[model samples]
Target: MSLPLYPEPVMEGPHGPPAADGPVNILLVDDRPDKLLALQAILADLGEHLVLAHSGTEALRCLLKQEFALILLDVSMPILDGFETAALIRQRQQSARTPIIFVSAVSDSETHVSRGYSLGAVDYILTPIVPEVLRAKVMFFVDLFKKTQQLKRQAEERAQLFREQAARAEAEASERRAAFLAEVSQALMTPLEVEEILAMVANLTVPQLADVCLVDRVTDVGTIRLVAWRGSPAGPVPLPELIADLDPIPLDSDFLVAKAFRTGKVQLLGEVPRFLDEISPRCDTGERCNRLVRLGTRSAILVPVVRGQAVEAVLTFAVVKAARVYVPADIGLAESLARSVVMAWERACLYQAAQEARREAEAANRAKDRFIAMLSHELRTPLTPILFSASTLAADPTLPEIIRDDLQIISRNAELEARLIDDLLDITRITQGKLNLSSTLTDAHRLVLSALDVCADGVQRKNLVLTVDLRADSHMLNADEARLQQVFWNLLKNAIKFTPTGGEIQVRSFNPDARRICIQVADSGTGITAEMLPRIFEPFERGQETSSEGLGLGLAISRPIVEMHSGVISAQSAGIGRGATFTVELPVVSIPMETGAAGPSSGEGGDSDAHRLRQPRILVVDDHADTLNVMQRLLQRLGYAVSTADGVESAMSLATGEAFDLVISDLGLQDGTGHELIQRLQWSGKRIPSIAVSGYGMKEDIAQSDQAGFAAHLTKPVSSQLLKATIERLLALQ
Candidate 1:
């Protein structure tokens, strides 16, 4: 329908019903007959009955008989004017709240309008009212009065609805909580059995969360047994007599769990305590002494377990132990949560038990795997030397060439095996930064050259093009010579192994401005991708589709060696399909410092590099047949009475009983280390110089040799030149 101009909901006529009618009655008071008639016509058409009285007293009489919807009065009336009539109407108990409007010839100034309304009129209307305006105004009041009535009804309805929603939510929460409680009750009601609850709690929970977890079960004697635990012992502790033999223990404070058990009401311990009552105890001593009352609990929640409407257990969370206190809503939530746990304990006993078994089995499997790995590593360490030495000798070009290339290769392999074993032992030590370093001063350049010499065979076998360009500078440096050499050789060998046959490899060296020399080893083969770049230096990290053909440990071992030398090594590459470069920057200076080398170069250290011999007598001794034969031949070739002995007794017999200028003896023999023999011979006043040779050069071995009057100590893999100089130096003292 097209809307009517000034459309309004119509009201019923006056005298419409009994003493209390559905529609309100209105009285119109106006001295002007036309104005009164106009208002009367409008009210009639509006569907509201109009009661018109020319004077104020007449209106009062009509109002006394029945309640009116409103009053439309002329403010300029001759007697008992609109404002005055409104006052009289308000004086009546029934019409006090009755709305009234003043129809006036006077202009509506703010003061006049205010005063007219203040005298008890609800509104003011200007004279010569249009028919639509009159109908609209009267209809508006009639509609508002109806709305006010309707609002009161709706408000009551809404209040009832809110109460219903709240009650329903509370009932649902209670039912779930009851289910949980019933489960807990049923669980405990059964005969006390040693169930797998401990493992269940650990696996189904703990570790993933919870800093502290403990289980408490009370005995009739009132002792609380701490049956199980999942986290640190510092977690919430249970009381021995927790509400023991008592109905509801008095919690004195607002502790959420305590209140739940004490008052049987759910409480949420939150980021902040609600008011004065719900906080927990604060200790002034012991490890938990730091709790601040104002700051609230370190833990966010404390939920009580109720069984048979009796407090049975408690669960606590430390969200605030690391952060903030839980809130009341949070406390309410925890109360519900605790209720669920209690019910679960009461209901799902079998599931919890099965979960516990699974956890135990998994733990056993992990332990088994660890044992196997440890066993494999330990077994491999010793077998490496035996296997490598046997293979090298059997593959010899000449069976009679003892102390030749094959023998040197065997020595080199044995040392490599020793180093691998040492690294394995020190794995944990290295991560903890507690690995010790036995440092010395030596030439960085020479260290590189020595390592290259050992690895050259592998490079040649690969048939990769390799070049070394060492800078012209002081090769002297203060470092761990053995460690730095390992670093260089590892990188160099890795380059050779990864690069394809006939692939070019370049080694560059320069005084990186004077303080350090940058030695970069670059290869031309499959390059490392950006994805694999970061983890290449980590121990035991073999790349996916690896190009190198050795143990994954080479680069890992190299990093530590370079760091120990007070230098840096870095690996870089463009991407896959391009080659990689490993750069080693080592510190250097002119003079080498004091080191533990007793001998010199075989063909490595420069002339006058301590091993530059001018003919010297020497003694070679060992219990092992192959080792002795090889050493004797190697020394003879260097032109040195390389006497042989099977044991320290014979070696000493030759030393003190003969005219030997220098002595070299194995620390181990058919007897024990030759420490006692060396001591006895020295005490006999035979001042013969000596050097110690051994397969094992552990810390104790070095110390014992030093104390027993050995002029120097050289581990096995003893080079020909180093052996010569050791003898020369000791004989020169004579």
Candidate 2:
């Protein structure tokens, strides 16, 4: 057979080649067209594509175009026979593994079959081919092709799925890191003790970031000490000896914790064995290495807790007995936790400092209150005698007019000095919010009139034109009578002090509404300037022209007292020299069904002849000799039999032996307090009604006297009329 000089065109479909799952091609090669036709008919039952190649050259072309499951080649061909074609097909890279079967008529020639097998043929068939055998052999290769294609597709799908899962895991890890830092920051916002903050940091680090955690704090002396430590519950328990050894490891040494603290940088050991090998030889002994090995430390990270320019502490985290290893991201997380601990420590320190400062301020305030009380006592003790002597001498009708007038001035001035002292104490009470009030169903009109009577002398001295208008229909109020009198007196006194001679002073009261009553004191003298109106009620504040007169506390004390009674006090001025108007507005209450009898008026000597019938015997006690002597003589002049004592012992002896209707005692005594004297007397079966006459007139002092069984608490430098009225009332109750 002569071979063709050139190759023939191979047959193919319009769309290049069939898909992997589509029908596989089977090549049929022969020198004769009839032989190719016969071979095609025999393989037709296999239900797969069979391509026909007239010569070995055409068959080689077919292999180049598309893949095939098997090739059936005729042995004796004209050019490029089956053996030669198969050899060439095997040489090509794409079809090197394609299966081949040779068909020949020379069945007995072993040389021809041996040559075909040597060229990589699977089978040698004689001509007169069995159709079933041919079909069965072709079907086997077709099935194998389909299974191989299925495996390739499955592998590609699995690779794509793996990529997606890796992306999701990275995203989740980033989210977890952010959430952990946020949780640590929120917990550190509140004030926590330094040790507690360290413990919290260690506890929060385990299982999430590390298997073991250790926190070291720098002490006041600048030595780093491990303050808190924690380990995961699932981790192996460390030996007690190892923990003790770990704590004493000097953090300023060459260890990782010390290095991080000294440099204020993070230290990470990804492989503990490698780090151990590097450091084991430098150590004096194997003790440190043994501890690290026993801890099962696989990886570790150490970060410094830095504040300002200094490292305050160091945080250590370790992964033990686990496959996990510490990475760079863990170093960042450790540093974040360290910062939170530093902030918490700072806040706790500030809170402790603030608490200490508050305690010191309270102590100083208490000391100031004590000093004021003592000064008031000393000043009032001497004035008691002066006030008693002048009032007694001024009351004598036979005294010359000039002498009586001089004694009246001394009395008025002594009273004025006492009021100034009371103002000092009242301002203290106001600032402390401890002012106490004794409330009753009081008529505001009565208090205004009484205040007017007290200021009558000052009004006369100034020769000011005074107009009184009381027109309030609902003037009754459930209020503190004495405090209201003080408020009214302060306004009227201020008006008398500021008004020049012949200036008009008008006092008026009227109901602005049924629920409230307004009392206004208007002056036409040196009026307040517009600039001074807002701060007129602040303590120690005074008009520029009137700053030389008093302590400037009258209006300051009045506003709070009025507000305490559910009222408001205000001032208005048309400018200096025109006049100022001070108005007080107070809530009013309706009259009750029945009215109780009014208590005896203060400073009233209430019919001495009527008191002389009973001849009430009173015991007066005081540490001041002058005050004691004046009080005894004053009581005698008021028709009461009085005995005196200088201290608690003498007062007790006098009260127990004598038959007294009232026992009046000063709160401060040389031997003991008047509170002790009254209690001792009552314990001795005396049971006499007593009154507290004290220079210590703070509300606490008065409460102490009342609790000690005193019938009344009368502040020192008491008037004879007030003393007489108090004695008569107590004796009458007896």
Report the C-alpha lDDT of model 1 over 1-734, residue by residue, as the tens digit.
11111112233222212123265677888777887777777768666667778788788788878767778877777767777778777787877888888777787557679988788776777766777877787788898877766676566666666666667666665565455445444444442233343334433323222344433344455443344444432334332232132233224433344444465554443433332232234422221212212222344344565666766555544332343334454455445545555555555555557778889976875565445334433443343335335544554566776656556666556656655555553443455454456676666667777877877887777787778888647567777666677678777777776778888888778886768878888998678888888998888875547654345777777777678777888889888768999998878776745567567547543433443455455665667676677667666665665788887677777776566556677766776566765786678776668888765444445677998888888755454556667765666556
lDDT of each residue in 544-593, candidate 2, tens digit only: 55455688999999999999999999999988788899999999997743
Question: Which stretches in model 2 have alpha-carbon errors above 4 Å?
Answer: 1-167, 203-212, 219-223, 231-251, 271-274, 284-286, 289-296, 320-323, 436-441, 590-619, 639-643, 649-662, 676-689, 732-734
| Leading candidate by lDDT | 2
Task: List runs of model 1 lying over 4 Å from the truth.
Answer: 1-461, 467-478, 509-517, 529-531, 544-549, 574-577, 586-621, 633-643, 648-656
Q: The CA-based lDDT of model 2 is what?
A: 0.81
Task: Give the C-alpha miss distance for residue 182 in model 2, angstroms.
Answer: 3.7
Candidate 2: residue pairs that collide: 3-79
TM-score of 1: 0.40
- Model 2 TM-score is 0.71
The 10 consecutive residues of candidate 2 with the worst lDDT sum are 1-10
Give all TM-scores, in the order shown: 0.40, 0.71
Model 1 score (lDDT): 0.61
